[model samples]
Target chain A: MTTTIEPRSGTAFKLGKGQFLEVVDPQGQQVSDLLAFNAHDTAEVISNGRTFDYADTIYLTTGHVLYSNRSNRLLEIVRDDVGTHDFLLTPCSQDTFRLLYDELEPHQGCFGNLAGVLAPFGITEDEIPCAFNCFMNVPVDGKTGKFSVEAPLSKAGDTIVFKAMMDVIIGLTACSAPKSNNGSFKPIDYIIHDHLDDVA
Target chain B: MTTTIEPRSGTAFKLGKGQFLEVVDPQGQQVSDLLAFNAHDTAEVISNGRTFDYADTIYLTTGHVLYSNRSNRLLEIVRDDVGTHDFLLTPCSQDTFRLLYDELEPHQGCFGNLAGVLAPFGITEDEIPCAFNCFMNVPVDGKTGKFSVEAPLSKAGDTIVFKAMMDVIIGLTACSAPKSNNGSFKPIDYIIHDHLDDVA
Candidate 1:
């Protein structure tokens, strides 16, 4: 199954174990925030700290598994055309705009978008953790420890695929922040394939 | 006023704006997880992402301000006897023990400890975000992006102090994990100074 998420908006859905999820940047310079939770337990949401601790690499790509707050495997990256992604940032929100872009009105950004869609799954605002940003660029300066959102390197049709390790609930957004999407908004594409063969 | 948090335990209390909070590692090699939320609004909690972005350093010390989710200043580090502390990892929990140490019984760790104390202020389990770990050592390999919780660098009587930027609710813990405390558990001390003159 394939679906399109409007720019600056998001949606939530479920995937059975062994299913494949492909998130695509149909247009260049777009960013998407992705979150996951164990279908059996909302408390077992995706954990950036645990995933980073276990993976040991901030730059995750194909074969990397997203770990849960409880340290269980939830999903594995089966393919990644654009490997650069951010695991450090909390999803942007009304506060983000008020802090950075004073000229524009504060939008809820990805955080609110996720909360809006994930509510039906019994997931609340607090259950949302830092997201796995696809096609977003945030480079950190080691000496200064400062990072800035940069334009994504993705081009039209670039995609990243994840294989579910367990039944899971997912919240995803076509990011709303101006800087995150190179100062413009664009829609995102996703597809669920029941088998690896279905992905290709 | 001064208080002591028992080994592997925690407590929470209100802090007035401009007051000083000094967290002491009474014994050497122990870690403390510290969290702050606006006293007026529990939803406006301390944020590591904003702090990291605005402060521009993961290795925070004297003179850095901790920011809130809404981009408000929450606390400022007034004194730091020990310089190195971790800003990346989440509070350790039951699953952390289950995944890392198979022989030891699973303990709720700092996450649970914080949740226990903060609940009274209307902050539920999900409201707890990543904490500001004092005297905890987690060094990330620049090339590999992997980080590990090493024993702290603090010595007996070592302390870190923060000046409240606002009236805030604070949660603190003397970490429970054995590895975090160099194979031992110990108490933590905190003093609330009504004024800078009270600190000395």
Candidate 2:
């Protein structure tokens, strides 16, 4: 098993040998990220090639490759127990924050979590656009043609692993979706491993 | 830009040719569930053929294709604006409902909106396994390896369209995920079209 801790701020590492990161929550739930980014300029780690349109994309556990826009392999889906994740959807915003909470103080209504994390890595807030909704469930309604949150597919310890195939800049944000049924401000645990190493 | 209203059920329909149904909320936000099903088995969709090792896989969006175990294209992602949906994740559940909210009656603790919609369609609740977290932001921490909710990537009026290359039975559930931050709910609206006169 390989365990690597990035304590230095603004430190970006290359996923050399395909590493698996397990994201766990406070309740031991494997909370995943809506979107993950690698700083590979050569397009080594961009997942979701032209298979699905960006605007309508949804993310799930298995059968996908994480590559750069240039189609460079960043991570390969190894274990997808959570089942699915959505890419087209955006995170709740200040407006949604207000809609979800009538008591939210003004100016405190912003989806800054991504920005907060990105800041340390020198990635601008504007650079952090709409990310993938990791573990949240949004099912579709055929009769009315709509979408609604359904029951969660993941358990407290269920996880998904990715084999990192390249050296890329990875950015992840702990979602603070105030509009979810699991809207509580809970935290998730993230672990990074070296290439060809057993994940934590 | 076609519109069809079913007066009897008070449901409306608007479909783009070769496009999947795009649902929206009153706020005009694209209601997240861009659906496609196998023309053969109403209960089966595609699997994540490339990412993980799972047989009966159903893709929400992005990485995986909804191909049948028989290697048939049950549902190919023609378009996805909801971004990458997570398949590893499942819908919210009763425990989560209770965990996210406080003071709500336990009677209200009942979850299973997906089943509510699918059950009527002959799809059992048990079939609703790990689904993708579409358009919902849940980020992972690279350092601490933690997970948290972020704002959604979608805005008001945004929607995704899909084309059913063949006749098929589709299931959807407009999520009524209550805001965990404020206990508020976001309702959704949608439209569907089967063919020229079969629009719903």
Reference contacts recovered by each candidate, as fractions? 0.31, 0.00
Task: Report the lDDT tens digits of candidate 2 across residue range B1-200.
Answer: 43321111112122233545544433332123323344445445322321221222222453334533223444444445555344423344554444443436522111255555455456553344333334544443322222344455566555444455455554444444443112334544555645424432
TM-score computed on alpha carbons, candidate 1? 0.88
Q: Which consecutive 10 residues in model 1 chain A have the weakest lDDT in total?
A: A139-148
TM-score of chain B of 2: 0.61
Q: Put down candidate 1 lDDT per residue, A59-159, tens digits, no spaces.
A: 67898999986678999999999888878787888777776677466898898999999999998775577788888887765444556788998999999
**Model 1 regions lying over 4 Å from their true place:** A40-44, A119-127, B40-44, B70-72, B119-127
Q: Which ten residues in a row have the lowest lDDT in candidate 1 chain B?
A: B139-148
Q: Where in model 2 is the C-alpha error above 4 Å? A: A1-17, A26-31, A40-59, A99-103, A106-110, A142-145, A195-197, B1-200
Clashes of each: 0, 128
Give model 2's docking category: incorrect
Q: Provide the lDDT at A7 for model 1.
A: 94
Model 2 Cα lDDT, one tens digit per residue, A8-104 = 1112233445566654433432223434556534222233322231212344456566534332455666766676555434444443344434455
**Global lDDT for candidate 1?**
0.85
